[model samples]
Target chain A: MAEMRREWIVNAVLAMALLIVPLVALWINEPFYVTLATRVAILALAGVGLNLALGLGGMVSFGHAAYFGLGGYVAGIMAHHAFTGLPMWIGVTGSNQMLWIWLWAALLSGFLALIIGALSLRTSGIFFIMITLAFAQMIFYFTLSWPAYGGEDGLPIFVRNQFPGLNTMRPWDMFILSYGVLMLALVFFAMLRAARFGAALMAIRQNPDRAAAVGISPFGVKLAAFVLSGMITGLAGAMMADLTRFVSPAMIAWQMSGELIVIIILGGVGRLFGPVAGAAILVAFEVIFGGITEHWQFFLGLILLGVVLFARGGLIGLLAGRARHG
Target chain B: MSVALFAEQLLNGVQFGLMLFLMAAGLTLVFGVMGLINLAHGSLYMIGAFVCAAAAAAFGSFWLGLIAGLAAAAAAGALIELTVIRRLYDRDHLDQVLATFALILILSEGVRMIFGPFPLYLSVPDLLRGTVDLGITRYSLYRLALIGIGIAVAIGLWLLIAKTRLGIQIRAGESDREMIAALGVNIRWLYTVVFALGAALAGMAGALVGAIQSVQVGMGEPVLILAFVVIVIGGIGSIKGAMVGALLVGVIDTMGRFLLPRIFAAFLDPAQAMGVGAALASMLIYLLMALVLILRPRGLFPAHG
Candidate 1:
């Protein structure tokens, strides 16, 4: 196919995969698959958030799981307190359930981003990566030790928190909530990419000193991108907690953060739909091979190594030939 | 816990530090010589423990198993260097991190698939199993023995690198990779050999530590983090830094964990004290790391010059 036609084909295929597949899965006789797809959607949303900082901004944060987990704990704690009859101070009429949970998740995650990014942004290169990882470890260890929550055992959501006119306890309702969040996150990603701030962020990633030479403050640009990236991951965490009806210290674990990076790579690094595609592949592999073999991670590792070694641009890069385009 | 308890903990801290040295020596050596970070160094450790455990079980000989484990791990390291890792020398750190991360996943799962998820135990050899009655206190003979072994290894490694022709080539490579290659040393062999040596050291650590702790999949991860911390504190490419940093971190971390709860209990209730104390203890080394980086970004013993 010609270049333009091939690009169109790639975009259409992705849309169909992202949109049509989930809807089809929802319609199918299997309730299990819809729920599975919803998990993918939520995880993909988290990855989309990560892709902003990592793929575009060139910040490989191994600490995003902190935001994702913290967002979860926020919702989990709020619901726990609310269920236990603690009166929330602000009594806005519509801000009763899911929206408030998500809003607070975004805000708290952003706040975390501000603190973590501020300290970490001081260092560059491998120092930055290790610092971020260490900070996340700090949070993880804190959660594990803090006994107010379930500690290592994790906190369970006995009743799915209420959403007006929606029975969120039901899997279908939960899937819709997660899918909606994923779509909104994707739109946010696209808009940010097109925005001038996004261009500036990209420029910072390419060469901060040079970008500064051109009068762009790399510091503020990176900080903004980090905050936005963190907030989105945070929202995904909230959704994840809702899906699982539980929150654990593991959500903030380095493994989760590393896995998020993995998804971006598997799909095709820096592509808009890369995270979604990557999440799809990972979740699908988990669902299928997990049933057949108990040790599927080994195979996943092999594939990942192959991708890193040979498929430098990732799956989408191979399919679309967007190296020069980028 | 009395002064004696503190003393024991100190010794434990030293023992742990020695173990960390064994782990970090190879890692630092490989990284120092070739600016490539190998995330799978932990996997090599895991491989060592697994091999030793399996071999010991089959042969009813712990010493033989340990030798087999070391050799297997070293061989695997060499193979990996030749097949996959050597190519990654020129690649960026992010690429290296990802690829190595992938290897960890593969290794842990592979071990699990083969050996099952159950943790394996390797009994200590007859000579090293008992405790030694020191003048001041009783100590695990094996632990003391490990300290001796670590010191010996450190000396041997120093001599090898400082005295031997191969060691000179490695030193030359570290100083200048392109120039060393131009001078007719087989750079690839140096890398493969260094990688193998590192893998062997890691395997030794795993086998030794496996005597103390159960051998399980993903066991290498925590050690890997600490090794990273060690390298960071000591300086990325310095052997001396790894040694010093490992000891400092081991002592500080152990002391912090043991002492913090007591400090906190004076100010708060027992329950809150434990929680706060543990959290602070966990954060201490990291806090130290941040402070060190702030003061000296190249690390405490950077070999950059």
Candidate 2:
């Protein structure tokens, strides 16, 4: 119990640091730092979504970028139509309401995940990795050639979308909105992990055959987890689009998917606060290394290789101690 | 399409397929023998292209550049295997993926740093520069030569694998690594040799393809994705499957791009059809992969122990 408390304290301190660092920047008149913090929150949320599948469910999807991109496109397409005073479908005019946008993003991404997960879950291991990647590539090519939106050029929102009770155009307000969503996601993730479903998901991950022997359907559990994972990631994607006020095929690129995986591994897979720490570290590295050299990626690669080889547990593991499972 | 254009496209598809085969063959071999997912395999391809480009420019001979590229790639592959990859053999797939992915970032940026951001071009050799008059149409002599080279390599590989002691050891290692190691074969050296051989094939593909496309940093990523799709459709660790899957993907991709727009034009207004058809055509190979997976979860030609 004492150890658990310490871990919670660590989580609290990590989340508080995320909130405080940006607020301090706001106090000192550095709005750019606030935006960067918002990016961390949004990216962390995406990482959390992936961790549910990869860390808990043991489905290493190399195509979550498809969901992320889809969510971004949903936001972008909606905002585009709204700005142009056009209806999207059957007199449903586009609106910049964040709530409506999130709902649609979740619904669409959930649907896409259902279709994709049903097919992808049929295969396992390396085949699963390749299939997910191929599916993402399918979405990527489709977007690259689609002329209606911006195609390869991507679509941009001139102004940030309005959030209820917040003027999201302000950098601070945007940061708060993203940070709040991330908090909500973390709470939900905690609840899910404690739930019976989460146990079933983890069971499937450890041993699918054994899980089946215990009266659990591994496929159904994994599929549910995958869909839920995609939905959360889609919401993060929507927020990301809002943060940048732009959506492009780059969001769905395999590289983006890889980054999300990196985030999970960097923090500690299956740990609740993993994504938060991972996101903070990644953004810090990007800011610091990027400021120093153009070849930061080369160094980032070395760091990542060292982490994978020498440090099985990531930032969370290093700071909070090894995850129970780890 | 006219008969001549159809024949020309058919030939083009085969040529493209053969290029993909070179990549897929090596990838499958590594996967089968090592059980490692080396994402940096594509980076080796980029290295090959860069080396070939620089060598050709310096020596004024494509042939010499090709040999240099192959040798350099093999050496790089072996060096990395000794330094990094040897440690990863017993690790999980995620570790392998991340480590290799890191290798890609380092290699790509390293090459970019040295070569500068601008793309370098490789000119075709004089002997293989012009067109060959086919009965239906004129085709690039270089492309025909590439096809010829690909076929010769494939045959040579078959012979090497079927007729050599090393090939027997490789087969044994794949089926029963512990037993083979117990038999006193130097497993470490065998792994290095297989890795280098695979790297050499990727180099050959890169050097050959460089003459057609500009040699550039990050040139290998798209081809890498396509090769993944090929290997998936072919079966993860099967050579015969790679060859068949490559041809299927190549031909389907080419034919879809060529015919889908026309087919859509007949159904929808021309402009809309063009846009929609192009979008779908671009995704044809992935769609085929999805279909194949739905039907054969283990791939069409899954290799057995």
Candidate 3:
């Protein structure tokens, strides 16, 4: 019980720090820090999306960036058309509304995940990893080929899209929006972990044959988790596109997928706040080391190697305790 | 297409397939023997190309450079295996993936720091630069030499794996690591040897390719991706599958590029045809992969019983 309390304390402190650091930055007139915090929150959201599959479900998808890039493309393509006053298809025009845009992004990514998951779930282990990666590469190449939408150069958003009451152009507002969404995602992730379906997913992860013996369909459960995971990632991608005001094939690239995995492993794979801690560490490293040298990634790789080899539990694990399930 | 053009593209496809086989061979061998999903295999390929280019430039001898590339890559492979990969033999696939992925970042950046950001040129040797005529068409001898090298390597590998005692130990290790170790085979040294061998092959492919294109950091990733597709289509841990799959992918990709544009031109406006055809052609390999996966989920040749 005492150990559990410590874990809770660590989790609370991490969450509060995430919130307070940005607010302090805003107060100190360091808007750049606020932007950094926003990046952490948005990336954390994407990581959480992946954690759903990787952590809880034991599905190590190397292509969450597909859903992520799709989400960003949705935002970029919509805003681009909106700016040009052009129709997206036959009769539908582009939307600048965040609510509608987020909904569509989730839907599209979920749909793609369904198709990809159906095919990929047929295989297990290394084959699954390669197939997910290959599918992402397919999307990456598709975007690169379409010269109409900026091709490899990527598309840019001239203006930030609107929210119901917030002025998203302001740095703090965007940060706040991203934080709120991240918090909501955390709550949803926690609920799913506690829910019955989460149990089924976990069961499948632990032992598929046993899960089958219990009458739970392993394929269905995994597929559902994959879609939900993709949707969350897609929503995060949409916000990320808004934060950067740009979307390119880079968003969907395999490197993006690798980065997402790095953050999850850096923080704590299954922990609720793992993404938050990871994104914080990653962005912090990027800032500090980036300022020091052009080859910051070399050091990042070294540190990451150390963590994977020695530091198994990540930041949350180091601070809190062994992961609950682990 | 003219008969000459058709023949030329056919040879190009075969040549491209051979290059892919070098990469796939290594990847499949490693996965089959070690159960390691190495993302940094591509980085080793990059290392080979860089070393080959730098050595050839310094010594002014391409042949000497090739020898240096193979040796350096093999040494680097053994070093990495001893230092990092040996620990990961027991870890899950995710850890292996992440560790190798990190290796790629470190190695690529390390190479960039050493060689700078620009690509280095590695010209084909003078002896292999001339064109060769075969019936209706002429093709570059350098490319044909690459094809010959790939075939020679393939046969050499087959003999090495099928005819040697080390090959028997390797095959035994693949099916049962403990049994081989129990039989007094040095499992540790065997793994190192296997890894080094795989790395050497990938490096050789990189050195060959570097003569045609500029040697640069991150050059191995695309080939690595394609190699992954090849192994998946061929079957993980199956050398025969890798070779067959490589050829199929190579031929299909080359032919798609050559034919798709013409097919589109026949039906669409000339200007539109070129654009749409190029786009579709670029995606043809992936589409083929997806189609194959749908039909054969375990791939065309799964190795395990």
Q: Taking the tens digit of each residue's C-alpha lDDT, what string does model 1 give over B88-159? A: 999877788789889888888888878988999998889898888776678898889888888898899899
Model 3 Cα lDDT, one tens digit per residue, A1-326: 77678877887998899889988999989999999999999999999999999999999899999999999999999999888999999988998999989999999999999998998899989989998998888888888887778989999999998999999999999999999999999999999998999999999999999999989999999999999999999999999999999999999989999999999999998888899899999999999999999999999999999999999989988988886665
Native interface contacts retained, candidate 3: 0.62
- 1 versus 3: better DockQ goes to: 3
TM-score per prediction, in order, is 0.94, 0.98, 0.98
Off by over 4 Å in 1: A1-9, A86-96
DockQ of 2: 0.85
TM-score of 2: 0.98
Each model's backbone clash number: 0, 0, 0
RMSD in angstroms, candidate 1? 2.7
- Candidate 2 segments exceeding 4 Å error: none
lDDT of 1 by residue, A1-326 (tens): 47546655885687666656656766776667777878888899999989998888888787899999999998788777666666555662222277888999999999999988877787666656766777788788888887777889998877777777789877777777787778778788888888999889888888889999999998899988999999999999988888888999999987898899999998877777788788988998888889999888888899999988988877777787755423
Consecutive 10-residue window with the lowest summed lDDT within model 1 chain A = A87-96
Candidate 2, residue B262: how far the Cα is off, in Å: 1.6
Per-residue lDDT tens digits of candidate 3, residues B111-203? 999999999999999889889998799999999999999999999999999999999988998899899899899999999999999999989
lDDT of 3: 0.92
